[model samples]
Target: MTIREAFTDLINQRGWYVKLEIPEGTANSTKKRFLEGKPVTEDKMKEILQRAGYRIKQVELWEK
Candidate 1:
């Protein structure tokens, strides 16, 4: 599947907006391309977070 197609799939699966912030000096090749407004395969999402020391945690949801 194409990169954009994969990203679309991820968005659908999550049912929420996914945003990954790359701190300064940590943008790898693929991530740099993504940050520079280029199309990046969504498969890199996991690797990016893993490299950045992020993990998934459940949190309470609130409706306001």
Candidate 2:
């Protein structure tokens, strides 16, 4: 399945709130790197967002 599809599936399966974050300060600069905008694939981004407790309660795409 596509990353977007996978994300949607996850949300549908689990109430739109995924948490995929490594414990703060556990990994030096890892969180920082993520926060600082490291490159990520759709699958990877989906995983991270899910781990970080971010759910797709709504889909909003802004074209600019």
**Most accurate candidate by TM-score:** 1
Pairing residues by index, what is the TM-score of model 2?
0.32
lDDT score of residue 43 within candidate 1: 51
- Per-candidate TM equals 0.34, 0.32
For 1-64, candidate 1 gives per-residue lDDT tens digits of 4444444444343312334454334444454466567866545665554444444454436798
With a 3 Å backbone cut-off (N, CA, C), the pairs that clash in candidate 2 are 18-53, 19-51, 19-52, 19-53, 20-51, 20-52, 21-51
**Relative to the true structure, how large is the alpha-carbon lDDT of every model?**
0.47, 0.50
Reference-based lDDT, residue 62, model 2: 82
**40, model 2: CA deviation in Å?**
1.8
**Model 1 segments beyond 4 Å from truth?**
1-28, 58-64
In angstroms, give how far residue 8 of model 1 lies from its true place. Answer: 19
Q: For each candidate, how many residue pairs have backbone atoms clashing (under 3 Å)?
A: 0, 7
